[model samples]
Each structure stands twice: as structure tokens, then as C-alpha cells.
Target chain A: MTTGVRRRLGVEERRQQLIGVALELFSRRSPDEVSIDEIASAAGISRPLVYHYFPGKLSLYEAALQRAADDLAARFVEPHEGPLGARLLRVMGRYFDFVDEHGPGFSALMRGGPAVPAGGTYAMSTVSTTNALIDSVRQAAYVQILSHLGVTDPPARLELVVRSWISLAESTALIWLDGRRIPRAELESQLVHDFAALASVSAAYDEEMGALLRRVFKEEPADGPFADLAGRLLTLAT
Target chain B: MTTGVRRRLGVEERRQQLIGVALELFSRRSPDEVSIDEIASAAGISRPLVYHYFPGKLSLYEAALQRAADDLAARFVEPHEGPLGARLLRVMGRYFDFVDEHGPGFSALMRGGPAVPAGGTYAMSTVSTTNALIDSVRQAAYVQILSHLGVTDPPARLELVVRSWISLAESTALIWLDGRRIPRAELESQLVHDFAALASVSAAYDEEMGALLRRVFKEEPADGPFADLAGRLLTLAT
Candidate 1:
């Protein structure tokens, strides 16, 4: 243990350190499976010291999940200079990176279980907090995608398309984490193509989406992912 | 309450009547909001009689959910005589009919909340049973879709596409149930179009998916949803 050589740390620094350690442990295993003792031991601190920073395991688990949520939300942030398909592909790449790194934790969070308080007074509130955190992440991703689309006021159909695509990406990741059967790169590109496909189908129904598609296609290069989707569809049509 | 002229029912008939009453109450409001007293009153029976058929509220909720789940799974069943698009549209129609009718119960079931036993000895097990019921419904829908495609062995990408579409439909319905500003008919047809869109995008990535798409398209008439999607894409291409 590093207890023998423990260095002084500020309160904020210690809390951050503890959260990092807890997240590390929680990532490897479900949060419910981890304990305050384990976190303290991993952090080279005492259980009492861990309690001094966070009241209980639930608070500590929320802190770790908060950090993970922020990191996940950040993965959707990309500059709007490149083609949307490539930007989305990059986002998917980083997204899968996080999912790959934290399989069990991600599953538990998405499934809303195992980490939740069991048969306690705080169970319902904790469940809602977990769901709120998940919803916030989805909202962040939705806003980021809308920003990339450059639409301040998305039509109802466009909104449906975006929200549906976000859910598709989420479910795709959850299923992929179940078994890494399909190649990651293919899934990533296919997700970008899925965005195009969703938008195009919506465009067929709404004039605004039709116009949006035209603008999107006008910016896409011949070798970009959107063009790639178009080429495949054209080939199939022929 | 029909208490003035109660009719005798067999044991099996009594249980079935209780289940139907519970489902009706649960559908009108969240299951947690409806109580044993209300259920008994609705069934025109005593609380002890209700308990005679089921142990507690959780078991009764499960029985109700089981009936709802079976009804939902059956909504996906269609004769293999028509175009895939028409068949899927019919499925979406009936699926949304359930969502529209049982808004609160469907939401609670999907979100995994409220109706669940709150911080009790049976809470965890009840939650898992609720989840199991939801998963079973998804499994039934997935198997039904694969059967519709007539594929005994679906490749990984095809599987992903199908599973992702199922999730998409679910999320779409959930979101639509929130505001429901968009016309129900539009969303229903769009969901069918979404299936074609998702499958076609996957086709671009895998030969198996590509072959599946060709078969799907060959069966789709010019005026069908699949052809409509093709028309939209081709219009954009030119």
C-alpha cells in the first residue's frame, strides 16, 4: 500500500482523487459491488477518511457517475467545419471508446440497476437521479447534434428524427457492449449512415427536412460518408 | 359496483376477471396510484377475494403486465402474404394503438418505476420481474420481425439493424406519447419507413444485409413504403 508514503492533499484534491479511484473500481465492476472500504484502500486512505469526504457510498457513486456523464456528453462535441458524417463518425468513435472502457458500469447505468440503492429510504430518489443523469446526457447529445445541424428551430419531424437517431445510437452501443460481434469501425460508419437514412426518410415526409437534406448534400464531398451512403443506394437502385 | 347482483365465477374465471380489472385500472392510471381497494371495487369483489387469487399487489401487477405483454406481442403478428412494408405498417399501427390506449402503464413499464414495490422486501425481485417482462416483450417483437424477414439465421449486422429499429420504434412511441403534436398516422407510417431506412443503411455495410435488402425490395410494390423510401432517396440523388 502507498499508505506509508502518503502525501498531503487539499480537500478538493482529495475528493477528486477519491472520485477517480472509485470510478476506476466502479468501471471494472458494478458500483454496487464496490464498497467504501475498497475505494479507501485503492486510494491509499482510510475508510474514515473516505467518509470524511463523502457521506456514503451512494454519494460517491453519484459523483463518479456525474463525471462519467460529463465525459460522455463531451464525446458528442465536435467542430462543425467538416462534413456532418465525418463529424458524427468521430463522435461515434469517441463514444465507443468510452463504452469499451466501461462496459459493466455503462450497462448498469443504462439498465438502471445493480448500482441503485436496494430496499432503502433513498432508493426511489437515487433511481430518479440516475435517470435524470442519463436524460441530461441524452439532452446534451441532442443539443450538440442540433448545433452540428445548424438549426436553431428544428421542425417537429426533424426533432423526431434527431431524437430517434440519438436513441438508436444508445441502443446500438448497449447491444454492441453485449457482444462485440460487428467490427467497431463498421458500426461507427453505419451509425453515421443511419443518421442520413433517418433524415432522408423524414425528408420524404416533410418539405423542411427535404430542404435540410439538400443543404447537407450540397456540403458533402464525393468521398465523404454521406456520399458513400448515396453511392451505395444508387448502386442498389441500378 | 354491481355489488347488488354479483354473479358467481369459477376459480379460473375469477382470476381472469381480476387480471382484466387490474389491467383496466393500471391502464387508466399508474399502477401504484391504483390500490387493492380500488381493484376489488372495480372487480365487484372483496379485497380478501382479490388476495385469494393473488398474494399481493406486485403479483397482481405482474399478472396485469403479463396480459398487456401478451397483447403487445400479438400486435406484431401478421400473415406472411403481404408486402413487408404493409405488414410492418400494420404492426406499427397496432403497437401505437396500445401506446395510445395505455399511456401511463406503458410509460411506467418502459421507465421501470412507480408500480414497482417501493423500498420493500420484494422491491428488487419485483423490479427484475418487471424488467424480465419488458425484455420478453422485446424478444417476442424481435423474433416476430426476423420471422417476417423469413430469416432463420440473421447475420450480426442484420441483427443490429433489426434490434436498433425495435429500440427506435420504442423511443419514438415514448417521445410521441409526451406531446403527440405530430399526427399519429404520420408517425406510424414514418416508423415503417424507419424500418426500411435502417435496413437499407445496414445493407450498405454488409453483403448479407445487401442481399436481404434486395429481397425486401423485390417484394415491395412501387407504391409500397420501401419503394417510397427509394423514390425519396432517388429524388435527392438527382
Candidate 2:
């Protein structure tokens, strides 16, 4: 038994540990509901020690939010080898996994936590930081989707299609988290098909998007989500 | 002459006039930046008269927001029209008209006005009321879409497609207002096509949605947005 021994952590390590602990607590409850005392207790540290690492709860909340944002952004990354539809499905899967794991925290983050002060420069900056983090996540996703399309300079229509799809995926996830009524697998595949749908519509209006879709479709397997969407739409013709 | 006469107004009319004046002021600038004195002056009344009608700026702001919400909701209404696509296009057009007219107010409403207080039951209730108004708009749009589809009871998939499109349209408008690089007419039509795209993908997954799409397509003209979507997807075949 090593009950008597206590280990000392380096400055950065202690901070990271506290963030990790705070995030865990926040994952289960809204950040506003979880106090600094609870976070310190969870990490086996004194309240003063917690304050030593971070000035206050708002700062700690921001640190935890930063960690969560990074994790969320990483979920969008996938290998370039697979078909685009399949890649997007995997991304949605991981995204939902994160949402499922961090329910209240995710909602609080997106909806703006209950504790958010209505006024004050300090509170305003915190809100802006929170917004900036959220925007960064959206930007990361936009870049990832563009990379999947392999387009460095996208036409305006293409940009709209991509950006709109990202927003669709986001709202879908947020609403899904509310009741989770539909099967996750079905929503995942449907979202992948949604991308195809948005792109197809954009392609109709823009030659550049048309060309991009053709290029995307050529790489798709017959049973892939993109082809699957084609097969479904074709049923109407018969 | 008539110019020397001061027109007397009833209490309700005066209150309505104040709200209209406040809404006009709020449309151009964020509500926080607009003061009661300005509203009073804009209405050609004294500041005490403005206070008599409303307790504080927040209450008046809420009233303005309520008026805006009703106006926004009315934009979604279309008389059970010829083609769903054309009807949706009209809806989007009018919707964007509101966004275009109330640019700052629209942004401030959706983003939460900069002056929102961080805490206090009064402020918290205001936030909830604001959120409730926003949700009412979404719900109104949802009901309107369902009515256009002529479905009293929709499947989960159908609900998902409609709700997701609503969210997509919202985010699209919010993003569009930032720089408004694309032509508004094009976006309005694209949004109509977006609805078709979202539904088509859902139809591919659910037989009920498939049946609904087939029924919908039968009435749609060859050049309609729905058929146009089908036509675009057919291009991938060649």
C-alpha cells in the first residue's frame, strides 16, 4: 500500500490535470453547476492550489472548454483514402460519440451556459472567447470538408454548399442530443446523404459544383452512400 | 390650421406606437445601443411617457422582439400554393427580406444582444423569454413546412428533414448577413433546392418518405425545383 506517499506535479502537468478533472466533472454537469471546490476535490488538490493554477472558475471553465473544443475538432479528421460519403459518415459517428459522452456540457457550451453574465467586460470577454472557440470548431470542420472535396479555391456556390452542410450536421447533432429519438446509425448515414443532396442541388446551379460532384461520384463505390443516394433518387424515374 | 392641432391617442395606440418606434430603432442598431430617450424622441413623446408604457429597456426590448418574432413567423406563411418548391422559394424570399431589413436586429436577436446581463433572475428570465421567442419561430416554420407538405402526422425522418432544413436556413441567413457576398435571390432559390435535397436524402432512407416524395413529384412540373433536383442528380449517371 502506498497510501502515505503523495506525488508532486510540475506546473503545466498540474494545470492539465486540473483541466482534465474539471472537464470530467463538467461533462456530466453544466459548467455553471460545477464549482471550483468540486473540481479541486475531484483532483485531490486544495482550493488555493486550484486557484494557483487558474485565477478563477470562469478561467477554469474556459480552459475546460478549450480542451473540449480540441477534442471535438479532432473528431472531424479522417484519412483521405476512403470515399467522401464514408469519410463523412465516420466523422459524424465520432462527432456523435463526443456529443453522447458529453451531454450537458455539450448543450451548455452550445446554448451558452446558464451562469453567463448578461453584462460586464470580463463576462463579455468570456462569452466572446466561448464564441471564438465554437467558431474555430466550425472553421476546422469547413477546412476538413473542403480538403475532402480536394478544392483549394472553391466557387461561391460550393462554399455555400459546404458551409450549409456543416451547419446542417451541427443542428442535426444538437437536436439529436435532445431526445436521441432516431437511431444514431441511420442519422449518420442520412447526414452523409445530406451532403450529397446539398452538393447535387448546388451542382445544378453552378458548373464548378457540377464538376466537383462528378469527380466525387467517380470515386464512389456502387454501394457507397453517394451511389446509394443516386440509386434512391433513380427509383422515382421507374 | 391642422398643423397647430396635437392628435390625442388612446393608451393602447400609444403603447403600440412606442413599440413600433423602438422596433425601428432596434432594427438599425443593437437594442443595447438604443436608449429609452431615443425611443421617446423617435416617437415624439417624453421619456416618462415611454416609461409609462414600459417599465424598463429590457421589457421594451422584449416587446420589440415579440413584434419581430411575429413578423418573422408571418413570412413563412404561404397559401397552399401550386408547387411546394415555388412556395418555399417565396417563403425564403420573404424570410430573407426580414433579415435584410433588420440586419443588426436580426443578428443581435440570434446572437443574443451584447447587453445581456450575466446573472440575476431578471436577466435570466429575459434570456429564457428570448430563447422561447426564437423557439416559437422555429416551431412556426416547422408547422408551416408540414402544412405545405400537407401532412398532419409526419414520420421521424420527415420531421428530421424539415427541422434540419429550418436550422440550415437559419444558419445560412445568419452567415449571409455577415458579408452578403452572394446574391440574395440566388440564395433564396438555393434554399428551396436545399429543402428538396434534404427531403430526397430522407426519402432514400425511409419508404414513407419515398412515398411522400413520389406523391410530391407527381404534381411538380418538369422545371420545378424538385424535378430540377432529380434532373441534376441524373447527370451523375452520364
Candidate 3:
């Protein structure tokens, strides 16, 4: 045991150190695969000391997940200039970059199990506040996102559409990570174009989306996606 | 042992009967949850008699899975009547109907497990022909699907789009099965529209898609989805 030279770290600092070590371990493998002994060894502390900071592996894993979520949420905080699609492209670019960086963790978080299992000794459902806290953070980012998309008074269907698009992006991102079946840049464009296409379709049935679509097109460039797509549709009639 | 009462049966017929019993049990819960004891009890036979037809649980499960796979492929066989999208809707309706009917088995099939894992004396991986048969059946359906979409002279991009659209349908189907978030009819329409939107976007960048899309439009209803979408796009410019 390396118990001879115990450093007198403050409670908060020691907790952070343990968490940092835990995050590194959790990032490599799923939480279920990781063990308490691994975290303690990596932190250069005994098992009891690791437990002192966090009650169990689930707690340690949650903290590490929070760290990654915070990093991802920060990437969406973008300047609202240029065309709406371009702005979203940058936001998505950042999102993809973060996914690329935290490949394993991003996948685990997206999978979100033991997190929302029907039964577990230390299930995420028992920790009600964790989900609440995460949802609050996520909803705030979606609010920022809706504003940039000019979706001020989003209809119920539009809200569902936006949320569904997010889920699609997550699933497609996972596939891209594994297969690179389509090029990364095309993947990004495909998602952007999908958003635009869905918005146009939504505009047909959703009153709020019509105004939102026009506003998006107003700021969009003459030769860009907005104009290009409209031209294609017009060509159908001519 | 019902040795005195047991009827004389052909080997293949007994094998089919045992597989049918196993499929019913598998259709209720996942393959992992099922046990040989339960299967024998359900079939009103002894455990050894259960083994007489199939060596173990894994073999039975694979046979059950193969049955479901064949059933699913059969559902996609729609007569090419009405619009292409309408034809696809009928195909998807059958698909979703199958999913609804065989909920647990459908999920397990999709999960495609090592459900009956190690030490299974009759493991499925050893039955190499089962996978080949399923894959060949699946490829034939994909070929049929590509033809229906007018994807003649398909480029690599078209193939990716076809395959990605399939994934989207699947992911969305799973979501529908769980949430019923959108009405099944709307889900079908949304998927159909998503395919059309993707095709148009693809047409712009792909020569093969450009030809394929026009051919699709030539056969499409003037006042149906094509006109409706073009009208919506024209609304944007004016």
C-alpha cells in the first residue's frame, strides 16, 4: 500500500481528484465493466478512501457523465450571426467534434442504461435529482437552440419535430462513429439539410413553421441551401 | 415418459412441432429468459424428449428466429399497385403490424442475441446456414425495395441513402413501438416524406438520382405529394 505518504488534500480537492481519476476510467469502458478497485488504484488511494468521496461506482460514474454532459452543452453556446443554417452547422460541427473526442463516453451517455433501467441496485431512477438536473441543463440548451432556429412560438408538432431531430442526430452520430459509412462532412450536411427539409415540410402543416421557415430563408444566402432547394422545387413546375 | 401414448411422427414433423412450441415461448419473453424445462412443460413432454427434436435451447431459439425472419420478409412482398409511396406504406403497415403482433419476439429478433449463451450444447453459431439463409432473404428484399424506389442505376450515394432510410425507419419504428409518440399513419407519412426529401436532395448532387427522381416524378400523381410539396416550396419564394 502507498499509505506512507498521505497528502493532506482539502476535502473538495480530494473529491475532484478522485472524480478525475474515475472519469478517466469510465471514459474507456462502460460503467458496468468498471470496478471500484480499478478506480481506487488509478487514483492512488485505497478503496475506502475512494468510497469516502463517492458512495459507490454509480455515483462516481454519474459525476464523470456530468463532466462530459457539461462539456457537450458548452459547445452549443454559439454566436447567433450569419444564416441560421450556417450557425446550426457550426453548432453541429462542435457537437460532432465533441463526439469524436469523447467517443466511448458519448456513446455510453446516448445509450443511457442502468441510467434508466427498470430495476437496479443503484439505478438512475432512484436518483431522481440527477435526471432532473440533467434535463434542466439540456432543456436550457434546447431553448437556446430554438431561439437560433427562430422557433419562438413552436407548435406542439414542431417541438416534437425538433426533439425527434435531436434523437436522429444522436443515432446517426453513433453510426458515423462506427462505420464512417458516409463522410463526416456529408453526414453533417445531410443532417443540416434534413433539418431544413423537415422545417419546410412542417411549414406546410404547421402555421408557426411557415413564418419560421421564411425568417430562416430571409437570412439565408441567395446561392446557399435555402435558395438552392427552392430553385429545385420551382424547377419541378417549369 | 408418455412412451405408450406418444404418436409416431416423421423426424422433420417432430422437429417443426418442437420449434413451433419454442417460438411461442420465445414470442412471449426473450430467448434468454426461456428455459428448456419451461419449453418441455409447455409442450407436455419430458426434457429429454424436448432434446430428441432439438439438441438445446439455442438451436430452438435460432429456428424460432428464422421463422420470424421469414415472416418479416414475407410482409414486404406487396403488389406494385398505386403510387410508389402508397405501395411502401402498405409494406410498412405490414411491417408494423408484424412488430405489434410479435412484440417480444420482434424485439429479441432485432436484438439478435447471444441470448442462449455459452455451454449451450446446441448453440446457433454452429448452424452457419441459418445466418446465410436469413441474409440472402434480406438481400432479396433490399433489391426489391431499391427497385420500387426507382433507384435504377443507383450510385454509391443512392445505396447509402436507401440503407440509411432503412435505419431511420427502424429507429423510428422502435420509437413508435415504445412511445406511440406519433400516430402510426403519420409516422408512415413522415417516413415516406423523409424519403422523398432525401431523394430530392440527393438528385441535386447525383446524376443517377437526377434521372431516377424525374422517372419517379413522371409516374407520381400531379396533385398528390409532389404538387403539394412544390406548392409549399413556391410559397417560400413568393
Candidate 4:
């Protein structure tokens, strides 16, 4: 007779379960509003068991956030098949969808809190990894587009364009999430169109830059950290 | 000897004093972190006097915020002088400078929070005003540019473009305030260059647009709400 709690789960499985529950609670309230006792009770687990796993509420919150962040960085940064514009759109969509799905959590993370919560340290390197990936892709795409269009500008201009695109995309997503201005489909369509306008201006593929991007897309295994991240995201989200 | 404190001030003068003190305290900490006691003490006034002038901390905070918002709305929404690009750059610079000068207060206003003491109520009209002004200016600019160019896209597409530009400008400002890699001068130059790139594609009647922009620039009045907001802002800072 197999009981629901009879089957033993591995450490990874239990850890994942803890993170899953934590994410939901964190998303429901600001950081200051959530407490470990609430999390433990909601999870139907003992306080001691929760403490053993997370050390503290802050540690638990950070761990959950890190998992989500790493999952996103891995998915978006990984090289993939498709035109640079298409690839960029897909990555941006993933991010927007994440925010849309987890509104309060995203708000807390981006806006931060009154003080650094005990567990939530300012992890610059972790966040920068994502930013750097975006910069690199943007630079490559910008160079490709500008060269094709016969616009003579320094490589730095490409950085500015890409960053601007990112800034706009982020704000747009945030506003959409906050305002519920349109249905999700309409919002995403508008986002794609807006992205294409900017991308079309900056993603003209020159021979050499195209070749470099192609190589980056090919040499790296398709099933890399990015795919892993996507897989994790699916597991948590679905 | 006519001591500065001896003479009874008018309603406007007293209101200004309360707003100044409120802005100063709100900027330094979350509304929850501040107290009426602290505000009165800091302003060199009695607690009862503070309450007499303004019902509560929330009212004082909103009054101060409303003035700032009104100034920003007038500047960004109302007609201004100069080329659209240059005008936008100047307005954006002013916005950034305002944020830089009164970061704590600005930050508090930007991040809408739950009514912290029993009397405090969260209001986000200031952010809305900023968005509306940006939209208005961008829309007017787009119409002029498109009419000049004699090319047409659907209104939706135009909205996307304008929204994209405004969002980028705003998010760029946010990043700048966050003290990220983008310096003020570099951000300005990049924004101008990108604006040019877009305008070059979309703009027509190069000479006419320039002339009209110049006239608009000349007509812009400096002695307005922005000056008033600045004056009020300085009072709060001390």
C-alpha cells in the first residue's frame, strides 16, 4: 500500500519543494510581510525542519530568488537557433512573462526593501551575470544591424541602442503588469512590434558579425545552462 | 527688532513651510519610518501647530508631492520651446536633475506604499502625471515628425513607437539614478544619437521642423511652476 508520504524523496526534491512554496508566498506579499512561521505552517512542515533547510527566512527567500534568477539567466543567455532579432524577442518575452506571472515578487526584487533583509544580500555578481549577457547580445546585434544599414557609428552606439531597448522593454512590461492595460496577447504583440522596430534598425547582419553570432550559436551545445534554466522554469511555473 | 518668527505669516506661507518640512522627512525614510513629532521638531515648530496647519503627515506629504507633480506636468505636457529632440532632452535632464537633487523624497513618491500611519494614504498621481506628460509630448512630436515625413503607419504602431521612446527615456533615467554604468553625459549623448537615428528614418521637412522647434524653444517661459517647485524643494531640503 503506497501512502502519499510513504515514498522517500531525495534532498534535491525536498529543496525544490521548499523553494516552490516560498516563491508563492513571497509573491503574495512584500518581504516585510512574510514570516518563516507562516511559510512552515503553509507548507505543512515543522518549524525545526524549515529552519534546518533554510537557516532563516532571509536565506530561504534569497535561495528561492537565486534559483529563479539563475534559471532565467541560463535560459536567455544560452546560444540558440534563429535570427538575432527572433532570439532577442524570445528572451525578452520570457522575462516579461516571468514578471507578469509573479507580479509582487518581481516588484519586491526590483524595488528592493526598506533595509536589506537578513537573507537578501546585495548579490551584485549574480545580477550582473544577467546584465552582461544582455549587453553582449545587444552589442552583437547592434553591430550587425548598423553595418548593414550603412550607418557609421562606433560600437559603443550599439551598446546604447541595446540598453535603451532593454530599458523600454522592462518599463513597458512593468506598466502592463501594474496597469493591466490590455490582454496578455495584445501586450506581447505590441512588445514584439516595438522590439522589431528597434531591432530592425540595429540588427542588419553584416557578413563578419553574422558569422560570429552563427559560430556562437553553433559551437556551444544547444542543451546548455540556458536549456537547463528553461527546464527549471517550466518545472516551477507549470 | 522684528524677529523673523514674531510676525504671523499668511496661509500660503505657512502651507509652504509645512510642505517643506514634510518633503525633507519623507525623503529620508519610508513614510512609516517618519513621525509627525519628528517633522515638527525638525521644522522648529510645535506638534499642535503642525497638526493645525496640515491634518496629518499624509496630507502634508501629498501636498508637497502635488506641487512637484504639477511642476513636472506643466513642463513635460504643456507646449515648450525648441526642437522636439532638444526640448525632450532638456526636459528629461530637468527630471533627472530633480531626482538627483531630492532623491530620498523623489524615491518615496515614486514607490507607492501602503498608508503607513493610520492617516497616511497611498497616492500615485505624480507617476501618472509624468507618464501622461511624456505620452502627450511624444504623441505631439510623432505627429509633427510623421506629417513632415509624409509616411504613415497605424495609430497603434505610432503609439508603440512613442511609448517605446518614453519608456526608454524613463528607464534610462531610473538606471542613471541608481548610479549604474551609464553616466549623465553619456546617457544624454546616447539618447540624442538614438533619437537622431529614429528621427532620421521617420522625420521629414528637416528645415521646417528645425525652424518650428527653434520658435518653440524661444517661447518657453522659465518663470513658471518648475521654479516654484524648485523653491519649495530647497526649503524642504534644509
Candidates' RMSD to native: 2.4, 3.7, 7.5, 14.0
DockQ of each candidate, alpha-carbon based: 0.54, 0.44, 0.12, 0.09
Ranking by TM-score: 1, 2, 3, 4
> Candidate 3: where are CA atoms >4 Å away?
A1-8, A28-48, A108-141, A150-153, A205-208, A223-225, A228-238, B1-83, B95-184, B202-231, B235-238
Candidate order (lDDT): 1, 2, 3, 4
Candidate 1 residues lying further than 4 Å off, grouped into runs, are A1-5, A114-122, B1-5, B112-122
Clashing pairs in 2: A117-B117, A117-B118, A118-B116, A118-B117, A118-B118, A119-B117, A119-B118
The global C-alpha lDDT for each of the candidates, from Candidate 1 onward, is: 0.84, 0.81, 0.67, 0.51
Model 3 chain B: which ten-residue window has the lowest total lDDT? B118-127
Residue B7, candidate 2: C-alpha displacement in angstroms: 4.2
Q: TM-score for model 3?
A: 0.64
The residue-level lDDT of candidate 1 at A170 comes to 85
**Model no. 1, DockQ:** 0.54
True contacts kept of 1: 0.54
Q: Give Cα distance to truth, residue A6, candidate 3, Å.
A: 8.6
Tens-digit lDDT string for candidate 2 (B1-238):
0122247789899888878888988888876688788888788877897889899888888998899999999988899969878888889999999999898888877763335332422356676777788889999999999988889998877888898899899878987887887888988988888888788778777888989988987888988877776676677566
Provide chain B's TM-score, model 1: 0.93
Candidate 2: Cα lDDT at B143 = 99
> Candidate 1: deviation at residue B149, Å?
1.5
Q: Model 3 over residues B85-153: C-alpha lDDT tens digits?
A: 677767778877876776676554443222444343222232234446545555656777887875566
Instruction: Report the C-alpha displacement of residue A201, candidate 1, in angstroms.
Output: 0.3
Q: Considering summed lDDT, which 10 consecutive residues are worst modelled in model 3 chain A?
A: A112-121
lDDT of 2 at A152: 96
lDDT of 2: 0.81
lDDT of 2 by residue, A51-71 (tens): 999998888888988998999
- Better candidate by DockQ, 1 or 2: 1
